[model samples]
Target: AQSPLALRQNILSTLGRTMLEEGVWTFPFTRWIKLIASELSAYRDAAPPDEQQSLRYLTPQDIHEEIKHSGLLRYGDTRTRVEFAHHTYQEFYAALALKNQVDDIEPYVDTPEARRRWQGVIVLLYGITTDRVKLYSQILGYSNDYARIWLAAQCLANAGEDIPTALSRLQEALVPSQQFALLFSVGLACRQLGRYPEALTYLLKAAEENPASAEVQFELGALYRQVDQFERAIFHLEEAIRLRSDFVDVYNQLGLTYYDQEKYEEALTVFRATTQLEPHNPYHYYNVGTVQKILRDYEGARESFRMALKLKPDYIEAKTQLDMLEKALSTGVVQMLEKIPMLSKMTLEQSVLLANRIQVKEYQPGQIVFHMGEMGDTFYIIEVGEVEVLAPEMGRSSGGVINRLGPGNFFGEIALLRAVPRTATIRATKPTRLLAISRDDFSAVLSRYPAIAHRLAETSSLRLLRDRQIGRRVDLDRYYDPGYIAELTRQDRVTVLMGDIHGSTYLTNAIGPELMVAFLDEYLLRMSSIIVQAGGAMDKSLGDSVMGVFGSNPDVPGDESLPVKAALLAALRMREEYVILRDKWKQQSPEFAHSGMGIGISTGKVRTGTVGAEATMVGPAVNMASKLSKLAIKGRTESEVYIDGVTRQLAGDSFATEPLDPAYTKKKVGVELEAYRLIRQK
Candidate 1:
C-alpha cells in the first residue's frame, strides 16, 4: 500500500501536467483525456527503449477506468467537465506547478481579486518551495496593497520558517498607519502556528497601537488560553466582550476557559447568557446544559438539553443526554424524596408510601409554574434549583421577586390543605425540579396520620398571612394616586430619553438585594419626578433603566424645539440628582462611590401606542436612545448625558455641547450617529 502523501503527490503530478499546459484547472471530460494522452505520449517517445517498456502508459480506455476509481477528481455541474474533488487539491497542484516558475505568481497576488483567487496556492507555495527568499521578496515588493503584504507575512509565519527578518523588512516598508494591520496579521499567524509567547508579544504591540480593537483583544485572549494563562485569557476575553457585546465567539471562549478552571458556576452563567443572546442556536443551549450538569443542577441540565433538542430535532447528543437524565430522575425520585426533612418525620414504611405517591415535574428558567388566583390541588417540594414567589401585581417580567426558594424548600402547602386559591405566583428563576403530591394523596396520608394535618394547618396559616403582607407591599395602587390613562395615539416626532444606573451589577453584588432595591427605589423616584416635571411622559422602568418620551402627549401641541429642550432639561436634572444620590450613598459605603448614571436623548418620529394592555413607544428613536445610554456608560467614567445630532440641532445654542470623537463614536455606536455631550444651558 502506498502512503497517503505519496499517492497524493502521484495524483497531482498526473493531473498537474495537463492543468499547467492548458492553463486551466477545469476542462471538459474528452478534452481532459486528450491532454493527458498527449502529455503521456510525448514522455513515452522521449524515454529510452528499455525504460519506455517499463513505463506503463495508460490509454484512453485506461484513463477512463482511472477516473472512475480515483477519488481525487470529480465531474463538475456538467458531467462533461472534470475538476479536482476539493479546492485544496487544485491549490496544492497549482502551487507545485508554480514552484520553479516563481515569476509567474505575481499576477495572482497584485490585486484583490487575484489574491482572493490564488491566496491558498500562494500560502501552500510558501510552505513547500525551497526558494523562500525569492517568494518573500516578491510579495513585499507589492507594497501598494497592504493586504498583499499582510498576506505574505501570514504565509511566512504559517510556513513555520524564521520570519523576523522578513517581518522587519515588511514593517519598515509600510507607513505608520498600516503597521497595526501587519502586526495583527503576523500575531494571528503566529498563534495559528502554536507560537504562543511570540504571538503574545506581537499582539500586545498591536493592541497598544489600537487599544479599542475587539479583534486584537480576542486574539490575545485566545493566545493566552493556548499558554494555560487562564486569568489573562479571561481578562482579555471579557474586555473583548465589553467592547463588542454581540461577539458570540468571544463568549464561547470565555466560557470554555472558565470550564477548564473548574469554575462551573461561572461557566454556567456565561453559557446561560449566550443562550439569551442567541436563543435559536442549539449549540448554545447544549453548552449551557453541559455546565449545569457538572454543577449538579440535574433538572436545569435536563431542561436545557430538551430545549436544544426542540430547536434541532436531529441533535443526537442532546437526545442522548435527555434520555439519560430522564432515566436517572425516574429511578432516583424515591430516594431523593426520602432524604427530605419533611418526609423524615414519617416512619420508613410511611416514607416509602408517600414517596411512591409523589411525581416529579421540571420547569425551565422563567417558566411560570403557577399563577396567583389559580385553584391549586398539589403540594410541591423543591428537589433542585430555585423558584421565585411573586405577588399578583408584580407579574412575571417586573420586579416581582419577593421570595426565592431553593433545593430542600417547599411551597403550595397552603393551597393543598385549605382548598383555596394560590395566594401568589410561582416562577422558576432557574431550571427547577419539584416533587408534587395531589390533594387526594395528602388527604389519604393525613387520614393515616392526623398529627401531620395539624402541623400543615399551622404552617399554612403563617404562609397565608405572609403572602397577604407581600401583596400589600408590592401593590402599586396603594402607594400612588390614580392618574388618567393616556389615550393610545401616534406622534409624528418625539424626543425619547433613556437613562440607566452604571455599575448596577457591582452595586447589587456589594450591597445585597434589600439595599439594592432601596437604592433603585430612591433613584427611580427622583428621576421619574424630573421627567414628569419637564412635560415628558414616563414610558417604562426596566430594572435599572428608565425611558421617557417628550412631545408624546396629544393634548399638548408645541414647536419641535420645545420637546428637545424639555428632554435635555430632564436629562441635566437627572444627572445632577444622581450626583447627589451617589455622594450620599458613598458616605454609607465605599462601593457606591464608583456608581454613576448615563443618559441618552434622541429626537425623531415615533409611534406611541398601546401593545396589548401596556403602553409603549416604538421607533428608531427609542432604540437609539437605549443604545446611546449603554454607550454613554461604556464610554465615560462619570455621570454623562449624550444626545443625537437631531436633538442638538433643534436645541440650537440653548444648551452648551461638545461633539464626540467621530472615530470613537463610530466604534462604540456601530452606526453613523453624530452625538454630542450635553454640557449645560448656555
Candidate 2:
C-alpha cells in the first residue's frame, strides 16, 4: 500500500515533535516502548493476512515479554496486572495532559517504560480516566473484540483511577458480575474521601452483589461506629469476630463499645479476656481497674490499679485511683484513732494491724468536697490540707468559717444516720489531704467504743440543726407529716389573718403610682421583718396581702418557745416603722394620712394551696382572714388587730380577750362564727 515508506517518515516526524515538546519523547520510557510494540503485535496476531498487512512486522513473543517487564503481570493476578496496565497507560497519561503542568515526566507521570508495555492495554480498553473524550477516541482506534477491550477497562479501575469513568467503561463493557469487586473498591475510596452518605449507597449495592465479602463487613462496621450506631456496630463487629477471632484490635473495640453503654460488668469481662489474650497491654488492666472501682470492689479495684501502676507507673488515671484508695484507708484509721488517739503509747506492731486497714486522700484546690444538705456517708480527718466552710443563705450570707484541718480534727461523723445531709459545704482551699472513714468502719469503731458514737451523734445533730436554722428553707416535716395533712378536715378550727393597706387603689392613683409602689415596698418589708422576728414564716406575698406562718416547722430544734414572742415583736416593730413612714408620706401627699391598713389576726386550722377556677383559689385560712380584714376596715379601729378565741388561748393569760356579740358578726354557712378582740394587759 506504499505505507512502509510513508510510515517510516511519519514515525520519525512524530518522534521529533514529541521530543521537542517534552525535551524527551512523550513516551520515551522502556515500558512505553514495550506497550506500543505489544499492541502492534497483538493486532497482527488477531488479523487475517489482508488485515494483518496493516502492521504485520511485530512478533507475539516480543509482546508477551513486554507485558511481563512492566511489573503489571509479575504477580500473575489478573485483576491487579490488568489494573496496573490500564492506569499506567490510559488514565495516568490523560490526567497528566489534562493538568497542563508537567515539568519532569520521570517523577510527575508514569515512566515511559510502563507506557511502552501497557500502550496495547489502553488500546484494548476504554473509560479509565475522567477524560471520557480521550478514552473514547483511544478505544475507537483499537481492535474491537469485546473481551480484551473490557479486561483493559477493569485493569484501570484496580489502579485507583477515576471512578465515574471506570464505572462508565464497565457499563459499556457489560460485565456487571465481574465488576463487583471494582465497585466495592470504588465505594471504599469514596468513604475514605469523606463522602459517607454517597459511599453508603454504593457500598450497599456492592454488598448486595457480593454478600459474603469480609472486607465489606469491616467497612460497614467502621461506618456504623463513626455514626455512633452502637447496636449496629455490635452486630457487624460480632460477625467480623466470628469470621476472625484473632482480631485483637476488634476485641479492644468491642470492649470500648460495652464501656460506652455503661455495661460495666460486661465491659469488665470483655476487657479481662482481651488482657489475657494480650498480656502486655497496660490499657486493658487500667480499664479493668476502672470497672472494679465502679462495682465498689475496693480490694479488687486496688489490686487491679496496682497492676496498672506497676505496668505504667506514670499513668495519671492509675495514680488518681491509688490516691482515692489511700484516702479511704486513712478515713478508717481516723475513726479507729479517735477512740484511741492515746494509742501513741502502744507498740508499733499493735498499731500496724489497725493502721493497715486505714486509707488517706488528698484534694486539689477548687475541688468541692461536699455540698450542703448532701448525705454525709463518710467523714474525713485532715492529714495535710485546708478546707473552707460557707454559710447557706440565699445570696448574702455571713457565718463562721473553718480555716485548717490537721491530723487530729475529724469531720462528717454525723453521716452515720441515713437522714443527715452535710452540715456545711466544704471545698479544698489548697492541695489538701484527708484520712477518710466510711460509715461501716465508723460502725466498727463504735462497737469498740460505744460512747464515742452516741457523743458524736449528739454533738453533730446539735451543730447540724443550728446550721439548718442559720439559713435554710422551712422544714415542714418538723410541724406535720403527710398523715397530719391528709387527716386535717374542714371542721378543724385554725384561724389565720391576712391584711393589706386599705384604700390602696385610691392611694396609688393619687400618689402618682410610683411613690405608692415605694410606700408599699417599705411597708411589706417592715411587716415581713416583724413576722420573721416573731418566729413566724413569711408564707406568700401578693401585691398587697401578707401571709405568715406562726407554727409551720415546729420540730426544727431550738427556739421552740420563741414563735409567739417573735410574732408580737413583729407587730410592735411594724407599728413603730409605720408611724415614721406615714408621717413622711403625709408631707408628700394628702393620700398618705388618709390611707390606713386592714389588720386581721386569727388562729384556726385551714386547708391551703390552689382551689377554684384553674385550681387557683386558696382555702379557708385566706377566706377567713379576708373577712376579718374587711371587718377591721369597717370598725373605725386604728391599726385594727383581731384574733379569734383559739388565738387568745395560744397567746396565754398576759392578753385580754372579749367575745364580739353575735349581732356584730356576719353569718357564714347559716351560723355566726364567734370572734374576739385582743390586747395586752394594761
Candidate 3:
C-alpha cells in the first residue's frame, strides 16, 4: 500500500541512522517503536548515548511538528493513531523489526487482529529473504529467537533448494535442541515438499530436542510411514498417542501404517479408536469403510460407508463409495458415476439426486465413444471392460493409442471442466459398460457447490499455468500501471496503432528464455526505431502488445494527419522487418521461429494532455483501435494491419486498402465503422 517513494524514504531514513547497524534499530519493529519514541536511548540503532538524545519524536509538539512538515504522511491529528506516509513504510518497519528479532513482534505475527490489519505488509516480508537467504541466516539464525527463528526456518523449507550446500552450512552451525520450534518447522516444510529423507533427519533432531511434543512425533511418524518404514512409524505414532491420546491424525496415520504392513486387524483397531476420538468426522468412517471394503468385509464396509453418508450428506467420495456398494450387491464389482476429485467438496444434493440421471450404455468392440474436436459435456466411468485413448501424434498414421484403461479408470472431466472440444478420442476396445454424467448435470453441480467449484478451478488453473509455462499456450495478458501524467489536448486527432505478437508463448518456450528475450528485445527495438523515425510516441507496453500515439509529440509538427501517416508507415515496415526476423531466427534458432503480429490503427479527435489524478481518455477512436488490434489477429498466422475508415481516408490514397466486412467490425467492436485492411503502400 505504500508508494514506492515512501518505501525508499523509510529504508533511507532507518538506514540513515549512523549506528543502527550496531543493533540500535530493531530488526522487526514491534511495540518497541512507541517505546523508542519515549526513550530513544535504548532503541538507538547504534548511536552513542550522547547523540541518542538528538532522535526525533521526543515530545508531543515535536511529533506534531514533524508530522505536519513532512507532507508525506496524512492522518487524523491524534498521537496514538498517526500513520506513516505510505503503507510500504509501515511494512518495511515490520520486516526490519522481525529481522532484528524484536521482542514485541509476536503480536504482529501471532495476534489475529494485527495480522489481518497488516496482512499485505506481512505477506511481503517473505520476499525480503528470497534472494538474501545468506543474509537472513547470518543475521536471524544466530541473533534472533522464537518468532524469527521458526519463521525463517520455514522459509528455507518451502523453496526448491536445488543447492543443499547452503543448507548444510546453516544446519551444521545450528543446535536443533536449543530451538525446538525452528527445528520442527524445518522438518514440516521438508515433509510437505516430499523431501522425506531430509524431513526425517530434521524431525529426528527435533524429537530429540523435545520428546514431549506430540506434534513433532506425529510428523515423524507420518513421514516414516510415507517412506515405507512401518515399524519405526508405529513407534513414533504410539509415542505421539501416549503424549496426547486425542491426536486423531496420529491414529489415522498409525492405522494407515498398519494397513500398509498388512496388519489388517491392528489397522481396524486404530481406525476405530480414531472414530471414538472424533465421532463427528465423516472421513474417519470413510477411512474405516475403505479398509473394510479392501479386506472383503463388504457388510462392515457398507455399514461404515452409510454412517459416513449420514454424517455428511454431500460427501461425494462417500456417496460414490456407497453407490458402488449398492451396485455391487448383485455382481460384487464396484461402480461409479464419475471420479471427479473436487466433486466430493460440492454440496449439491440436487446434483447427487441427478446422479440417477446418468445413463448406463454398452459399446461393442471398435465402436467410437468420442472423437477429438467434438465438444462434449458427459463424463464416463468404466463399469466393465476397456477403452483405448487415441491422441494426435506427429508421426503416427492412426492417432497413437496412448492408454487402455479398464474398470475404475474414468475419463471426460477435462472436456467437461473446461467446456472445450475433446483433445483425444475414446473408443471401446471390448464390450464396455460406462456410467455417464451429462455436462448439464456437471455444470449444475459446480454452480450449486462452491467448494467443489473452487477445487476444480484450482486444478484447471494449475494445468493452464503449466501449459503456458511450457509454451503450448498463449494467455491473453492485460495490465495498467498506476500514476499517469494527465496530458490531453481536446482537439488533437491522434491516430493510435496497436501491435500484438501472436504465438509468443510457443516461441518463447521453443527457444530458451535467454535467446527468446534477446530475440524480442531486437524485434521490439526494430519496431520502436520505426515509430521514433515516424515521430510517434510509444505510450504503453503490454507484454506482447505495444501502444503508440501520434500527432502529439513535441518533435513532430502539429498536423492532425501526420501521426496517422507515420503509424501506417511504421506498421507496414514492421511486417517487412518481421519477415527478415523470421528467416534469421529460423536459421539461427530454427525451433523457435514463428509467424508475427497484428495491427489496429484508428484516427479520432480526443483529449490528449497532462492529466490529473482522475485522468482518462474519452473517444470512440481509442477503443476502436485497441479492439481492432485484437480483431486483426483473428485466425491468421502472417502479420496483417487493419485500419478504421478515418485512418484510410486521412491518408488519401497514400496506401492501398479495401473495405472489410462491415458486420464483422460492427459485431466485434459494437460500433458501425468503415474498416479497411491495409494491403500495401502505393
Candidate 4:
C-alpha cells in the first residue's frame, strides 16, 4: 500500500504531465477538465485498435469527479480558476514537467523572474534530474547570485545521489570568497551520500574557513557520530551548542550521540535539557523517557512518557512506554531514585526511604527560593532548570549572582549540616524544579547510614574550604554578573589587530592639544567604524592606539580563518582610509598629514575575561600584536602593516605577505619573532 504522501506525489505528477503537454500552468476548472480529457484521448489513440476498444478512457466528467474526490485541487473564490491544493504540489509537478522537457535548465534560471517563479522547481529538479553534474555546471555558469548558487548547492547536497562529478566541477569553479559555502555544501552532500572520507575532507576545510559556524559544527558532529567517533562527536556537538545555545536540534543530536555510547546518564541530562529548551516538543519528552527508562528511573520515565502523550495524543511510542512502565510498577519493580552526589553513599533502601521524604518544589523565574540571612534547614537538589546563588552584601542592587546551579547540582548543604542562616540567596533563573529534603529527614537517613553521613561531611567540608578560598579573592560578582563573567572567561583562538598613530606626540606638539584632541577623535572614530564593519570588536583605545579583537563573538558565524581575514581587511581599509584622511588633514595642517597609522595583527589562542571590573584579553598574541604595531611605525618599516607568523598562516592565500628580515625584527622588537609585511589581499 502506498503512503498518503506517495499517492499525492503520483497524482500531482500525472496532473503536471497533463499541464505540460497542454502548455498551461494555471487555467479555469473547465479548461483543466478539457486538458485532462485531451490527454486521455491521446493515450487511447496511441494504443492498438483492440486495446483502445477495451481501454478505460477517463472523460471530462470522470476527470472532474476524480479531481473533486482527490481534494488535490481547488477552485478560486470566484469559482473560475483551478489550482493545486498546496503551492508545494504545484512546484513538485512543475519540476517534473521541466525535467521531462528541458535538457538545459540554465536558460530558465538565468533570469531573475524565471528563477523566482520556478525556484522550488529548480531545487526539486536537483533531486531527480539525470546528469546532476551538467545541471550544476549549467546553473553555476549563469548564476552569480550567491543565494541562488547556494540554494542549488544545498539541493545537490541533499539529493542523496552520488555526486563525485558534480563535486569535482564545483571544486574546479570555486571562487576564493565563496570557498566556505561551496565546501560546506559539498561536504553536506557527501555526508548525506554516506561518503564519510570525502565529507570530512571538505567539512574540515570549511571549518578552517569559519570555525564559528554552528551549522558546520553540527554537521561535523553528526558526521563524527556516523563514524563512531564518540569523543570527537561530543566535542563538535558541545562546540555547536556553545556557539548557539538555543540550538535545540544540536542538543537532541548530542543526546543521541551519548545514547549511542551507552552513557545513559549523560544522555538523560542532554535530553532533559532539550525539554527545557522546547517544552512542548513531544519527541524531546519521548527521548527523555527512553533515557530515564534505561537509567532505571521508572517514575521519571512514566512522567516523561505521559508528557509526550499529552503533547501528541497519537504518539504510539510514548503510549507503549507508558503502558510498559505501568506494568513494571504493577509487578513491584523497584524505581530507584536518581543517583545524586550527596545520596551516592546511601544504600537502595536508605535512598528510597529518603526519597519518600523528599518534597518536590517549583519556582518561577526570578522567584527567590531562600533569602540570605534567613535561617534554613532544607537542602535542595535541582531536578530540572537553573537557579542563581546571589550575595547582596557583595553588592549590586539586584543582588550579585555568585554562582549558577543547574540540574543534578545541590546547594544549601551547610544548612543541612548545622543550624545556620542561609549564606546566599537562592533564586530561580528559569522555571525550576528542585527536590528538597528537610534537615530532620536527611539526619534520619544519615543516622541510619553512617557511611552516607561521612561522605556528605567530606563533600561539605571541601565545598566550605573552597568558599573560604573564594572569599579571600576579589569578588568577581561585584564587578560583573556571574553569568556574564562565566561567559566572558574562556580560552579561544582569536585575531588581535592593533593600530596606532605614528609620531602622535610630534603631532600633538605641532598641532597643540586643542586641535590634536579634535583630530584624534575623528581619526579614532573612523578607524573604529572600519574595524566594527569588518566584524572585529573594539577591545580598547589607549593613548594613540585602538585595539580590536576578531572571533571573540561566538554568535557570529564564520570560518576559523575568518577572524584573520577580517582583521587583515580592517587593517588594509584603515590604511586606505587614513591616507584619505591624511590628505584631507594636510589641507588643514601639515602635522596631521605626516602622521601615518601603523597596524599590527596577530592570531593565536587568548584568555579573555573580566579583569579589574573591565573586559580584557590576555595572551602572547596581544603582546605580539602590540610589538608588531610598533615595528610598523612609518619610519621604522617599509610597510605600515606588520603581522606575526601565526596571523600570516591563517590569512592563507587570501592575502599577500612578504617575510620580514628576522634579524631586523629581533633587533627592533627585542624578541626573535617571525613577522611579515602585509602587502595586499590577493
> Could you say which candidate leads in TM-score?
1
Q: How close is candidate 2 to the true structure, as a TM-score?
A: 0.37
Q: What is the descending lDDT order?
A: 1, 4, 3, 2
Ranking by TM-score: 1, 2, 4, 3
Candidate 4, after superposition: displacement of residue 205 in Å?
1.3
Q: Rate the local accuracy (lDDT) of all candidates.
A: 0.72, 0.53, 0.63, 0.71
TM-score of each: 0.38, 0.37, 0.33, 0.36
Candidate 2 residue lDDT tens string, 1-682: 2223332222322333333344332343454344445545544566578866755554433443454464533322432222224334333443434233332332311434444544443433333344543443233223322333333334454455566775676556644444555456556656665777766777677667767655555566677777778888777767767776766666767777777787778878877877788777777788887777666555787888888888888989888877776565554552345343223222222333335545678799979888764666776767676876543322122323423444555566445434344545778888988767576764665566655456655554444434332222222112223343333323344334465666677776776533554355446545654554454555545566665545434345544323443444444445455666677567557667766665556555656465332212256555666666555524332455555555656666655656776666655213466666554442
- Candidate 3 regions exceeding 4 Å error are 1-103, 111-153, 159-177, 192-194, 330-682
After superposition, which runs of candidate 2 have C-alpha atoms over 4 Å from their true positions? 1-161, 166-183, 210-215, 238-248, 258-266, 276-283, 286-602, 606-682
Flag the better candidate by lDDT, 1 or 3. Answer: 1
Global lDDT of model 4: 0.71
State the lDDT of candidate 4 residue by residue for 109-208, as single tens digits: 7777767666777778888887665676666553235445556666886676557776667667655565567677777767766789999998898888
Residue-pair clashes, model 4:
7
Between candidates 1 and 2, the TM-score winner: 1
Q: What is candidate 3's local distance difference test score?
A: 0.63
Q: Which ten residues in a row have the lowest lDDT in candidate 1?
A: 476-485
TM-score of model 1 relative to the true fold? 0.38
